[model samples]
Target: MRPSIAIAGTSNSVMARCYAWVLSNSPDFDVVNHSRGASSSTVLPYALGKIDLSQTDFLVIDVLNNEENFVLLGQTTIEDVKNNLCSALDAAAEHGVVPIVLSFPRQNFLNRERVVHDAIKAYCRELGVVFVDMYEMVEDAVERAPVTVYKRSFFDGVAHIKRPISRLVGSRLADAIRRSFHSDRVATSDHALAFDRIEFCFPEPEAGLIERQNGFATEKIACLGVGESIGLMDSFDVVGIAFNSEMTDSVLSTDHEQVISLKGPDKAEGRELMTVILPTRFRSSRLTVTGEPGAKFEFVGYARHTDDRRARTRVARRSVLPVPEFDEQFKKDIALLAVT
Candidate 1:
């Protein structure tokens, strides 16, 4: 028997041509869409009520476009989106519905959607639902063809994806849904939404350094000054460090700062993944990651930072890079950093 798939969200979800593409390509798949072209707050309740949960083997949702737009314009609060989404998920869970979630794509790489994605990610992690990390998805697509972003925008003010990107997004999501259905794995770390935790950081005192965020965090990380850096004050275990994107200038790790380099795999675009790592042992040595504009640095594993007067900054800081979610769309055979 073919698995029944139900698609729901606002225009962003339903407008992607991927839905029809998936149905037409997979002869054994049964697909139904319950999404509409308005704000999710307005459309979601109705979409949920109308969907036949009994027949839905998988219910895939596209979050962000509706919610993000609302939050950006002050039409809705992030809290309201969270509350309404959680309520919908609760009802889906009660009906034995297997939920698969996704966030819509963006060209400018806004964190507005990341807020929505994170909201759903937290709930889905608790419920063991699958989230197709859209940030990672589009990042790969953008690297392939930067113009793909335009295809993702509203077409003729219809709030729908263009034909080309629609096909791409749809086909990819279908594969992800099937794989997620079969793979019985749930992301254990808070990194499920792709935002790496700050093992240690020098945020402005009382400026705030939260690990998880649900709204527009304009200043998530303060940009470091020339020759100034942030790092572990005392030694702790560390597997790797991620140098997230939008960097116009390169960041350097001098030989003296020997935390060792745990390099990540090459991206699909053949761009080297900019990560620093060390081999299989814990060192008590301090590891400081310097920063420049256009890049966000995330240190992996437990580390420490001295939160003194220096930790506090007069200047506000935020990440120039977009949210760093896991790049799960592409599959590549690669090796991990081999440490001594």
Candidate 2:
């Protein structure tokens, strides 16, 4: 259950692809790659639910070039772009996704101040969505153009220039997404679930005794879960966990168990926890926390499998973890006791 992300923008949008590629490779993401061409408007289809809005935790909109062209060519005004952005933001909010607006990348020949990039940036500020400045990265690349021109030894041909510029833009966009996902704004909750430290370990030969050491080296694990009552589908964030295992030469491996410690809200005092266990063969696995009748509790399990033939042949039936079964009244009481 990796955090799902939705990317929206023009088909040729470099920033959109960069974010998509990064998220696709990210162990923490189950990415939904969405790109509409110039024929489509931004706010309409998104609001109509033609797109899977519920699956989107991160919404990235790159409207710089389109909006700028609209204003500069007299197709629209700054106010128009602002209005459209506002509508889009409202639509995203309605769908319960965190919207991120990306300022247009600076073009080599375009006058920066005259473009609608600033208007888009301002709109994002007004709407309270995350605003990322791609202009700075574009500006740096422009400044380095002279060296590039000299190295190429061809003044008339500008095709080679697109390569470096695209890389620079893509890299910056990826870096921004990486930083934003880990920011304090994301980790903190309205209630007070601030995680302190998280550690993951494999079950030792002795049941209930997790090895003090790390798990197998090759398996990469990332944890994603949600409280059963939380209606918001994309309500969780990926937390990095440290593990000490004997199977690997390295102390840490990307493929390992994901252990998360949940911090209670201001009024609550205890932590609710969950873990994602990555077996060697399954696509993913989930461990949920459940409370029992008195003070007892346990972890429940759900496993995922893809259609990979090799995995199916290698792995037998999935194992279910021991979990405490609670009756309706006890479950209700436990829910009432847990923090919002």
Candidate 3:
């Protein structure tokens, strides 16, 4: 299936004028732009909340934002901006949403050491988020056509970037999205989750430390059985809809909370291993797993992946020609380790 991407940009019309316009012509993508003009970093959370993450595979947010109108005017602080961005990231992860942050085309304004972009970069690297560097893209454009860039101006008045430049950015951004879909990103820890995968070794239960939420507790699994199936849901987002019968009295708790609970159940024999993950700006919260009723199962280690890791790693072999081995006889003392 063709992957989808959502554009969550703000004023200055970069996404509207450039990225969206270019992507509109591409058949490989289905773009949903939620960009609003005159919006600032302060409105990011609200802006993100409006996006219907379901049926959406990727989210695009811009960095190196407009410095003059937003930051300098005190619409938001560097710290608050980070907080908002981090929150949105958490929401995205819950839905298996991949966020690709686009770089600001230029440092049109410099406010507070450019910490916004720096923080975003650090978070993306930590979380394995895809980042497309617009600077390099723009630099290549200018270097290739210095005269045209300076003469006609790549931008259309005030801040809107011309459609041509936007199309170029969109093409590169599309390529990055495609690559990420077919690639496996690494998550550093067992409790870690990435856009590509989430895995954690099941923790052993203690006598009095098994925490429960609304009487639902996730237990460790040893193996899965036939006819057993697993699915994911976010309690925080989906409410009032009866997704499954098992969720009754179910609660969402972290590993730390579960591990620190007073006691564990006597048996986990009938429950299947189910894992639900929601990654954050720093890292994701703890996961909870449950099994389908009437299934002969017991929970074990949990794992979830968007793509098969092995399939993603399948590399096409290039036919290698045999190289002749060199010997002292063949060298014939012709070569010497000499400065001459």
Candidate 4:
């Protein structure tokens, strides 16, 4: 059987479908992508959770572009960047999967801030992680060329390089995977121990606690009515939720005194997955959904980290940017990516 490679990244990974296409064509490998667009390092743990690393050989990460964007918007900090990076690496280690972190080229407008990417590179060096400097590779390939070329050649005028450029990048990524085999496994001491306890919890749809509160289920999601409560049966520092797009503002309270107000997205945009931070960690707490009369909420899931800080950082969806038209040849592969 060929080795399997999984991708966890932002829009670049979703938009540049040809990269995974190129890798899948290689005789020596199989590829699966679990990338979501408009995401940052903040979503790595959630994305990585979807991958069964026991059957996967390598994980490729490309979130520096969005991470920097988050920093530029003041939604996160350098400290959070380090925590996010370490969370991805440490999670990969737990399953014995090798991780290859990629740094893609930033748009000309964002070229001024290199702090996030620099911190990532330094952290990788310190932990002996495999770091792929695709940013430098792309820059070196287009030496002495005008800057407008990136805008013209890229899909989003940023990191999402259009194919055959994406195909070329995929080929390079495959080469990097082969090269990683020669590297040593990460030593236990090399892990940034501070962010070592990253964990995700998904409540079962049929839990008795859910049924007792008049909670119902559609598909696999548990629906909680206003003033209803459900137990996750695990410790969590953050809760991920979504509500009916038409619902009015609502609030969620935990036994730990954590209360989060929920605002539904515009009816046109549909529902959105959001993260809510619990001010205090709870070992045996239950979350109760409360809102205005007739208001209801859907409890998606929760994430448990060393503290609430890691869960507080949010990366806003960037949908206003234009993306190039998809290539017909790669449409099948592109359709398979979780672009949202």
Clashing pairs in model 2, backbone N/Cα/C closer than 3 A: 213-244, 213-245, 214-244, 214-245, 219-255, 220-255, 220-256, 221-255, 221-256
Model 1, span 1-340: residue lDDT tens: 6667776665554443444556546766687765534434433444564578777666666656556554665544555454444444555555555666666655443433456557666755554555666555544544544233332332324234345545555666666555544554322221122211122223444423334221211223333333545544344333223232222133435335543332332333433222211112234444344455553444322222112111111111011111223343331100010000
Tens-digit lDDT track of model 2 for 154-268: 1113211233333333444455555555544332112111111111132223224221211211222222223211111122222212211111111111123433332211221
State the lDDT at 139 in candidate 3.
40
**Ten-residue stretch with the least lDDT total in model 3:** 313-322
Q: Per-residue lDDT tens digits of candidate 4, residues 1-340?
A: 5667888776666653467667766888877776655555655665666778777767778777766766776655666556656776665665666677777666653347588888888877766666666555444434433322333344445556555566655765676566554455433334323543445565574752232111111222456778887786555444233233233346778776767665532443333332221112344467787867876665545555555333221111111211123333233232222121
**Global CA lDDT of candidate 4, please?**
0.55
TM-score of 4: 0.65
Poorest lDDT segment (10 consecutive residues) of candidate 4: 314-323
RMSD of 2: 24.8
Best candidate, lDDT-wise? 4
* Per-candidate total of colliding backbone pairs: 8, 9, 8, 0
TM-score to true structure, per model: 0.47, 0.43, 0.48, 0.65
How many residue pairs of model 2 clash at the backbone?
9
Number of the predicted model whose TM-score against the real structure is largest? 4
Which regions of candidate 4 fall more than 4 Å away from where they truly are?
Answer: 72-74, 105-109, 146-159, 179-193, 207-220, 232-236, 239-296, 306-340
Which is superior by TM-score, 3 or 4?
4
Error of 4 at 221 (Å): 2.7
